[model samples]
Target: MTAIFRTERLTLVFLVLTITAICGLPLLLLFKIGLTAEGSLNIAPLLEALQSRSVLRALWHSLESSALSALFATILGTALALVIGLTNVRAKGLLVFLILLPMMIPPHVTAIAWIQALGPASPVLRWLSIAPELGSDHPLYSREGLVLLLTLQHSPLVFLLVRAALRSFPRELSDAARVSGSGATRMLVKITLPLLSPALMAGFALAFVAALGNFGINALIGIPARYTTLPVLVWRRLASFGPDVLPNVAIISVILALVALVAIVIQTVLQKRMRSALVGLPQAPLDIALGKHRLPVEALLWLFVASVLLLPAASLLATSLVKTYGLDLSLETLTLSNFAEVLWRQSVTLRAFANSTGIATLAALVIAGLSILLGYFLVSRKAGQRLMAGIAGSQAEIAFAVPGLVMSIAFILAFIRPLPIVNISLYGTLWIILIAYVSCFVAVGLKPVVAAFLQMDMSLEDAARVSGAGFGRRIRKIFAPLVAPAAASGGILVFLTAYNEVTVSALLWSTGNETIGTTIFNYEDGGYTTLAAAMSVVVVLATIVIMVAMNALTKKVPAGTIPWRS
Candidate 1:
């Protein structure tokens, strides 16, 4: 008993220290540096940054693009959720999966795919004889184009949230409305929309924050368009001026972080108020009979899905097969050399693939292990255990809620200096990127385990305890087995998310530590369009394969453990 108690206390301390070091300390250091000058409290730098024309311009651009993109995404996502979630759509599972597919794909890959799809030399467009003339500006290289891609990238996020909300919608009220002779259109407009307002607001806020911190689309498209947003501005500043301008960059990051935090708070308040205004007994969601309109609606939905998914994919594949950019796809022009170059010839590509695979694997395993331990305390009856869990959970949530770029900046500030006791720098090493991945995705990996723990029967643990099993013994022998599937699912989720993600690793990657995402981005940025296309095609296929594997585990884990599956 004494040993068990000592072990528990030590575990609690370790959890607290680990989470604080990786998640809490970085953001705290970021705020400290942003709000102070030479270790003294000062707002002068922040004020000057706000007053700078370039900073102000970037800020406005960020807000404008985010707002517009979010607004459009909310409309699109909500519409899809309503049609698919409520009505009897054909292949409902497939539709939901496709809708969520874009969200799973890294934004930079989406950007690259879309860039190829719409460029002057777009194979699809050219084959259709609608390609823009050579030397014409690519249509997507402007503020509007940035918003369009951002909208497409984030709409799936909104779709997921709204669809979940729809699943919990009160069917009894809708039935009553129908019994009262309310038409579908009128009831949908009056009752359903009113009740779904909270979700709509929540979706908009989520989309807004996502767009505000978006780096890939903003950088890839906006740079050529000369439309600078805060995230891009920070990257450009740091990349161009080096760490000598860390203070200015930190201030800009703080601004971006504050905006994201404010959006979250606003969403929470609005969702709560709207939720409080309505009350209903839980029931199955509505399944309205579309009757004659069903076929056309399904056709429209499929058309929309194909336009978004297939067009870019076809363009990407076509681009990769071509021998060079700006060449039409033909028997003479089509070649496998681009894929060969990226897959085998380019040493950087091979190294990046290995680095990303290794880092993502390690991060996944570490997060999965931590999730199991932390999730146990999250559901523990003891106050001390729960307290530790709460602290760790809140930090993870805040880390995840902010933009990845913001988190990257926080990490930069936190790790640029050597550790206190170890006296070693992690700033330019892959270690920093790995640590950042664990911190950023902790919430992602913990969620499923927490869900599993919530659903678990406590009798097993009680029986183990009655048998004189220690806490560690009980967890290892009993709880661990029960939640292994959920933990695995969570780990897979983390791997998929971090595998090709550029945001968190964008600033952290050094010469030898190039991640797959950074490598692809570099290829595209450096005018190696065919090479980028080939790598992106590979990434997309790999992502689909992993997602399919997770999909196979749908029956083993909790219902919502797999987002696309649920």
Candidate 2:
């Protein structure tokens, strides 16, 4: 019986139940509330919710903005990927790194930086003598701003996906085309574009989902523009009505979830087609010489990168240094008081930093440890491996695919009451947020581990079992060391993602439990732009330092563990 307790069936059951609880219960609760009212079947509520003017507008806004943003980002990102990926550009590695930096910065931070970079008091705009009129609303506080900022924030995701697909591209196809006297442009259009279509579709779908779920740009720009998306609508309902708005929030969440589901399905289909189309050894990138056009193209690419990367950074740095956001930088006006105020002087800021670090760290460690067990069970060659994998994978995918605002609402709906055993409420506390992060990021942490397990040699574990070692012994002594590197990498990913997470914590955080992301958002909403900039600078700098440290350690880990490595 003791041995049976640790059998494979037990492991599988435990994994399935954990996944269901984390992702399933919240989702189930959401649909139930949305599709029911007063313990009776009620399509009227859903129909009424859908028909409401605000809801209709939000739906249109979400769909319209996400579609446009995805289109723009896909075009720009695909172009950049083709140019840098295939061309014999100098410093290609560094250029790719810079292009990807925007993805690392949280969306809210990017919004804040851009707002500061182009507002009425912008140093850049002022220097160009095109700053908006004083006391005028921010030029970026509109629907157009949401579209632009969302595109910029999500373009890197498209770039990464498209570039990865291109890395596996067969050079022979292009070579054969070249033999037919196909020029560079002709080769690109004739051979490369056809093979890259699936990837392009996949990239566009990724960007669409990202933009649809984006809360930062919407919160900062959409609210001011009276442009409400589903994500922003969810946040507003919760803020304005709290828990009493659960039914309405659930209906909104269902709509958001449906949109996310459609995007994921599209992306998954395209990815399958992409994989089926390409199966061969990856070769050197097809080097296309730009000839006389080389310098101009390179300069153009750098200029775009600078606009997205450098301008926002310069804005944040300047804002943090100045006495106030509107003040010009000079020997007389320049000061670091905002930095001091946010970094050390304010108890809220200090507590936010500590709380965010603690919560993110806890979530990372818990997910890492669980991922080993989950990954092992997922990859086991058992009778029901495929079924188990499908169930677990879908749950993880759905949890991550939905917007943070929607997920936060689900958490509130599911956990607002006291626990069954302890009889203690988890709502209105950091514990709820912690639980949400675990559910939200479990997929991220498990990805590398599952990959690692797929490639691991099972002979060592088989030998350990033959030596009478139990599941605990084998895992602790054998699999632990083998899977540690992948687990560690995934943990870092979860930590980085959850640290500056604003959308999930926006509604979940309270006065004493503010996260770094929510703190920055709060400062901005309170008209403390400089203070917001200071905190954002801190978050971005820390994120970069962590990424650098990871880069240094990537060489030691197994290949293919890091997404950016390939």
Candidate 1 per-residue lDDT over residues 1-566, each given as its tens digit: 89988988888789878998999999999999999877899998888989999999999999999999999999999999999888877899999999999998889989989988998889999999998888999999998999999999999989988888877766777888999999989998988888889989999998999999889899999999999999999998899999898878999999999999999999999888888344576677778889999999999999999999999999999999998887889999989999899899999999999999999999999999999999998998889789888999999989988899999999988889998999999999999999999999999999999999999888887788789999889889988899999999999999999997999998999998999999999999999999999999999999999998887789999987898876
C-alpha TM-scores of all predictions: 0.98, 0.95
Lowest summed lDDT across 10 adjacent residues in model 2 is found at: 1-10
In order, what is each prediction's RMSD in angstroms? 1.3, 2.0
Deviating ranges (above 4 Å) for candidate 2: 1-7, 38-41, 269-276, 558-560
Per-residue alpha-carbon lDDT of model 2 for 1-566, expressed as tens digits? 37734575677777788889988889888888888778877778778888899998999999999999999999988998999889987778778878888887899999999988988888767767888998999888888888999999888888888888788887787888889898888988877888888888888988998899888888899988889999988888888888888888888888888888878887877667665455567798788887898899889988988888888788888888888778877789888899889988999999999999999999999999888988887777664855786687779878987888888888888888998998999888889999999999999899888888888887877787678888777778888788898999999989999997898888889889889999999899899988998899989999988877778657655665665665
The superposed Cα distance between candidate 1 and the true structure at residue 481, in angstroms, equals: 1.1
Regions of candidate 1 where Cα sits further than 4 Å from its true position: 38-40, 277-281
What shift in Å separates residue 378 of candidate 1 from its native position after superposition? Answer: 1.1
Evaluated with TM-score, which candidate comes out highest?
A: 1
